[model samples]
Target: MFNGSPFPVDAFPQIIRNAIYEVEQHTQAPQALIAASALGVISLACQNRIDVCRLNNLRGPVSLFLLTLAESGERKSTVDKLLMEPLYQLEENLFEKYTHDLTVWRNDEAIFNIEKKSLMSKLKSEIRRNKDHLATNEKLKVLLASHPKSPVRFKQIFNDATPAAIKDYLCGYWRSVGIMSDEAGTIFNGYTLNELPFINKMWDGAMFPVERKSEPEKLIRDARMTLSLMVQPNIFKGYIKRKGDMAKGIGFFARCLICQPGSTQGNRQITSPVVSTEYLPIFHQRLMKIVNESIARNNENDRLCLRFTVEAEKRWIAFSNNVEYEMGILGRLSNFKDYASKMAENMARIAALLHHFNGDEGDISLLTVEAAVEISTWYVGEYVRLFSKPQEFTLAISEADELYWWINNYCIRLKASWITKNTVLQYGPNKFRNRSKANEVLNTLYSQNRILTEKKGKTVFIAIAGSIF
Candidate 1:
């Protein structure tokens, strides 16, 4: 239903473009290409080492939630695996190191526990014998405080995990991670997962509290997660229909960057493997470097913050004002005001991600901000086309056309200049689901001047606007 092209793939950086081209060569879906590239960038951003974007006291994170609508066999999972291969490798390396460290920590912990228990026994005996016990008790307390805790495994990617499990992982390991799933139905259909609030809070970098009755302590952690979900259009629509307005009413869908790209199913030709010829090695190297730097910086609890240059600030402000103006106008984007309102923040986030991806450590440049704005505009268009009831609009038009055809063919064949509502409803091309819907269609036709309505003896009749008997 969208009138324009897909995301501006050319506007991305050279590395991103090369990755997209490589994926597209394998899969003919351009939407899959863009989604895969964006997923890669967001997965890198999940490191949480990069500084936030600050402008006049407003700050935003580089994390994003992207959803792509495609049918099965669109190669969505293939593209996801291709881009996330490096992260999987990184996880494997970290797991090996974690296993080694865990073994050493367990040995040290056993020694510490035995020593603490011996000291506690001595302290209790001294207390019973009326001897000095303060020193021994103090020593036991110090040992307990200094005991080595268990090593937490380093993990950055997840698929098909429940909300509680994800929370536990984020609270124990890195506070940032990415959820990449080709079939998002598992997530959407999970009845036990309280995902709406969990996802919303994570997107805003808010604290999530996990309480357990078995343990006396509670954990409150700030978690950041990036989501890349690729689902078939039919499945997505089914979710929407079942959930009704819940997703939009709660602003879940509004926060997402959604795209439903035109399919190239039958047109895809068998092509040779382009992965070897592409710059994937270089791309993987850059991603690994970024992840390593992020891990190093985060280990030291150092955050790298960036602000816009003066020119970039001015451009950002102008873009914000323009979007605000457009949203205030009636019918401009009334159906999508929620999504439109967040466009500015989303644009800033994109700019920050682009700035980091370009390996720029300085202030964000005006060119970068401009490019972000351009891409954000495209995202807004995609949001409207995908979620603004364009299909319903098309259905209405089709029903109107069917009614018009019926009037011309049936009514004119009978040599009747007018048709009663009852007759039309009985013989109409089944364009309506019920009597009320039929009435609505007839009223719409009357309002459009396609037909004239008359009331005679409590019966309403419709006639072609310019027809002659």
Candidate 2:
């Protein structure tokens, strides 16, 4: 008989935000795979003294080809220790220190003080005001595009979207992590702890407008529901809407948020800059794998929070908010939520840097959530920034390195169903071309068109594609 109605629907948006935070607490699938591969490549380069050879020969295509050809080391006690031991030791030491800081998040006094802040008050108000609007089953595309305050308000909606219990639970986990500093009170820098949407938009770019072609009303409903589920009790600690100051300091660390081939260029703070659709799922898949692994490793229970997963998908699906433009300057950007969510993920990395110094697991976790929020924000901001500053990131690289970067970074880790649908390996050359072959793959993964399939069948392919877990 118990349901989640008593909680404000406005708060629901924050829950959807958990996917972003959970992502921050973890890594993206592609990033991890590339990082691991990079480690291996870098290791070999260092060992063989082939650094110059690797770097010089590193074109995108060659890099990818090399990845396939790279040899693996045997399981030597010393070899494993030499490579993984140090990192594991570092993590253990860090975790030990992290637990001490977690006390701050756990204490009732600390929790109460955070909830008492000005940010939470405004967020609560925003939630009430926006509730009925979202309930109308109107597509977010038209509503966000047309609204003058779409950018800021949309964040509020998103920030407030998660459920209260889940938020509290995540907060609890942060407390468990115990990673905060005295000068900065908590590990998270700018995320007002209680702040709602303001911080989410500030460092990140504003939300972009786009047109929706699907069943508008249904999509909106699904989005809302999905977002709500993301922050439900079982997922990430409620919805953390703000990344606060911790997110702002790390803006200078990267290459480019939107590295499109042509058309919309540069890296400014925008929604989804137009990028190749071919690459979107790949990028998402990479991140999703990291998230799933983190969930499996961290959550006390085995079940992955439904709301968290849904929230992640919603981010990838948002027409104007989630995607970027690549070569073409025409046509509307894809889903908003999805695009914005990706930018938010990028911003979060900065916040995580700060939390790392605190040595608190709980605080680290909080910071992780905050960092994820920042990345999502960044993804969006970078999209917006592209229009004015086309050609922002001018880092030079050989064509081969670039190709490898794309393949290693995005392609192998894709999250969309089309990945299974279009693969040639499943049934030779006729795989994608043959409906039966493609369907066979789909059937193996999902339940041949049934509404729901066995839980085991839902492998969270996006996560598995790039996961260590």
Candidate 3:
């Protein structure tokens, strides 16, 4: 199998890049996994306070749904713990305040019930005696208006939850929260994902209603959720084998940025002076600032819609058009149409995430959007690599084909019988230069008899097949 490309860490802003570097150095986790963990933290802090306005004036959530596949000993939990330390710390503090508030609410409710009952009895007595009763009626109205209101319980993260429980929390406790789990089997293997369509709706920030036999119908609106899941490969495979039809039919997986990065185990050597866990404190400190600001403005009318600069909007329009055109029946991206369709909007979300995390002033800029495009393109390729059939053109196979086309073009244009490996590495497609992936593609093309590779002295040359030229 072809290995996935390393994440484009430099494309991210300095704050996020530092966090990713620190986490990867300290834990030796896959770079892509650490990047995804960083994104989840950004989503939790920004989703409630900010939104992204698309090129066409469409406003959407500044949230992301991420899924990472890895084995048991890949340090998935470590990445999550390091990045999400702020959220957990905040949740702990909130729980203490909630415990105290619950006590006060119970006492107030008891006093309210006693006063209400007394007024109700007094009203009946006054009515029976045919008295004026105006004073009693006024007292009852005042009493009803003064009825105690229980505090809205607060929580920020959950490993596993039912839809009803989620609605209750968002409606009563917090306006925004996240479903972050390292052992995602509890969510994927259980009933949480049984309602595939509901999960998809949650990702899109759509309105949801639940009808119950025992109570009134509930409508969930203006509530936001961000999901980051890390599951074992076998567990995810089983879920897809059993329920992929339903999930894919409803476009559940398309809403996610999915990856299964090659493992880095057995290579994390213990150095004499271990790498410092630096920048985590900075990550936490910056995130808590956003959290404090978001908490003060997590209402329906308070979201800060991040508009793109003029240059950024033009770039986005061009990108959307290009991707849409590539989704034709015979187009290379035809098989992964669902992902291509939503990728542009997700790119906008990524730009907003980076912009907010870096404390950039004013609107989202062209530079940020371009960097976001680079990151999104890599993940989309990863999605295709993981989901497409073997014979189908995976990203690696696509790179190989592009390289072969380049060789043929070079022969025709330059009148050269062959090209050097160094030339291909320096002057080929940007995706064609990674030595490991490039070598694998060369070997695969050779097995297919599609190209000829010749060695002369210290140089390697590639030429088209049937070299009658």
- TM-score for each model: 0.76, 0.16, 0.83
Best by lDDT: 3
Worst 10 residues of 2 by lDDT: 221-230
Which pairs in model 3 have colliding backbones? none
Off by over 4 Å in 2: 1-303, 307-315, 318-322, 326-379, 382-469
**Model 2, span 276-307: residue lDDT tens:** 23432332343334333433344343211111
Residue-by-residue lDDT tens digits, candidate 1, 98-215: 9999999999999998998899889889999999898998898899899898887887777777777787777675777887777777766664124687787777777777766785
Q: Write the per-residue lDDT of candidate 3 for residues 82-144, one digit (tens) a residue.
A: 888878988899888988998999999999999889988999998999988899899999989
lDDT of each: 0.73, 0.26, 0.82
Clash count, one per candidate: 1, 109, 0
Candidates sorted on TM-score, descending: 3, 1, 2
Query: Which candidate number has the best TM-score?
Result: 3
Model 1 deviation from native, Cα RMSD in Å: 9.3
